[model samples]
Target: MMGPAAMLLLLLLLFPVASAAGSRTLVFILAGQSNMGGRGGATNGTWDGVVPPQCAPSPRILRLSPALRWEEAREPLHAGIDLHNVLGVGPGMPFAHAVLHSHVLPPDTVVGLVPCAQGATPIANWSRGTELYERMLTRTRAALAECGGQGKLAALLWYQGEADTIRREDAELYTGRMETFVRDVRRDLAMPDLLVIQVGLATGQGKFIKLVREAQKGVKLPNVKYVDAKGLPIANDYTHLTTPAQVQLGKMLAKSYLATL
Candidate 1:
């Protein structure tokens, strides 16, 4: 019943759909500070010398570059987060691997990571309407657009609070600030039920570490969750997670994200 021209048009329309069939992209926003940017074993504070099995390369795992282009994800996921530091192993990749291979999401799904973490950044940096916050928003939007506007914001992974632990005022106000952050991020992204998985502090044992941890643990948002970093091993700097710890933390984060789904 269809003409040749109509059949040709139909085929053209179906081509893109068939090309994209059975392949979905799971987008995750990795935002926080230095630990989130990764600081694995380095040679003279430059270049990451360690790459664990959990952080191995995979074509299916992609990252948004500083130019806002999607590329194969590699270690030191946050090159756009900080220009000065050499990114090493972080929890982003391991988490992606776990989620992609997990039963929760489609096994054929491609994992997309939008890294926007900055080293030593405080929760205040992510305050709504601020420079850093605006930058994160822009980068996140760019990543979403890169997925042909078909991907989803699977989760916003946060691993900050160390810098806030340096001051009582910052720590004291962490809970309120974090509450605002969750609300604003969800509101801006138009995903009210967005999952926010916060990784509790393992570094910064002194100062207001306890207060910050309590604030992170006390968050009661609808879909917000926290992952404990207690007893996790740190690097020689005593502030960043070691290679093994990063792998373990990634798995823990993946598990937490899975529970929310």
Candidate 2:
């Protein structure tokens, strides 16, 4: 049996479409913990909420379905990932909207979102060689395969670290682990200079929150940028970003990505 990384490489080789996907299909991966998976609403653990107009589904925006195929993009981008329960508004939608409307890419380009976020998960869950990491890699490969030789990964939108804020050690070592994770992802995907937009932890478990946020903002690496989540509105639970905030954050992510391009 081949490892997940090996399997993905094989898939890329076997499916010429993966590499053939040039710049016609702009691909992005929405990753991280609960916030990224989207738990925001008037109620907790429920998808019941108002869908912001900015996040309205567009035929041009496609998402990686659970079946490992591309389909019309929708809210709660992480629905395909099994670990998340509630599927509410996530930042991916607004981010896509911003990119589509912005002058970053050609007008004819289509956006492909690969959702692999798991709610409430810690950084350790996404550590290299972990199940979550392997699953994410496999799904990413499947998304590339779905491109049909016309798409390519543009950037990665990461919003996480709340869970890791609970532990002092996790908060302390976050910078190193996160740097490693970014390096590993880029290297494995054969994109040495892939753009990685890491969102800073807005709020979390009391004392350690600052540590994680500091680590996030202080990360120094090529092709890696940090987006501030400070002052972002929160849900009723005060954990996840509210729908409006998600939209704002998504736009912020898009702006950050566009600056790089």
Candidate 3:
């Protein structure tokens, strides 16, 4: 006895409910500075057109609000290229696909990466006092809401500290702040098992590297794990990772996360 319009609305509501009852979703957050944001040269490779089969096809990736100031690319390739000519790969795409390949993901899993990273931003900016963290948190919450609301945060991958290396006095404080940030995020997301992969800076920044390492080691969070990159090949600028380095870094990240599962 319902009108066509009303029937369509009922179907829309019921369809999502039916889908949710049987679907499994996992969301991953990529948070850091330029390295995690992916600054590297383009390359011709087999992964050029490779989109993770587990991810939804055609616009397989989505940018949620974009707290960072850099240009965004949904595909792994660099910006300013036609889809037909896509020939580059960013760290996120391969990393997510690797998770799928390793069978570490749940069935019907749709990996959502919330990239909140800026070039040259220090750890202090990511703290609670600044607007950066607030912006990232807002984007993160909105992304999860779109997916299905709370409990979607599967993991957080953090690769930062190059800018923070400039300030020696704040190194120890930075570690404490990181711990607090992780605790707050876990508490807010209500996912205590939310794994955190913190990648150490590979830019060869002097004493600060040691401090950051110590800080990561000292953090008492059981869910947090530090991924080492002590001898990796950083760019000639002495900061960013080159194209090959990014690929290696991505593989390392993928391996670490898979081992946990």
lDDT by residue (tens digit), candidate 2, 1-261? 889999988986775333434338888998898778876563364677678888998877888888887777777677768463767888898998999999768877888888989877888889889988988889888888777677788898898899888889999999998999999999889999999999988888546999999888778999899899889998767677888898899999999988987
Pick the winner on TM-score between candidates 1 and 3: 1
What is the per-residue lDDT of model 3 for residues 1-261, given as tens digits with 9 covering 90 to 100?
999999978886766433332245455677776677665543222333434333222222333434322122255433331123223334665566566567656655555566666556777878774776776677677666766443266678888887767667767677788888888777776776779999877773445767766776687888788887667766555666656666677678889887887
Flag regions of model 1 displaced more than 4 Å: 1-22
Write candidate 1's Cα lDDT for 3-34 as tens digits: 99999788856663322321587889998888
In candidate 2, stretches whose alpha carbon ends up further than 4 angstroms from where it belongs are: 1-23, 82-84
Q: Which candidate, 2 or 3, would have the higher TM-score against the true structure?
A: 2
RMSD of 3: 6.7
On lDDT, who's better, 1 or 2?
1
Computed on alpha carbons, the lDDT of every model, listed in order, comes to 0.83, 0.83, 0.62
TM-scores for all candidates: the values are 0.89, 0.88, 0.73
Candidate 3 deviant stretches above 4 angstroms? 1-23, 42-90, 149-151, 204-207
Locate the minimum summed-lDDT window of 10 residues in model 3: 77-86
Task: Check candidate 1 and list the clashing pairs.
Answer: 34-119
- Give RMSD (Å) of candidate 1 vs. truth: 4.6
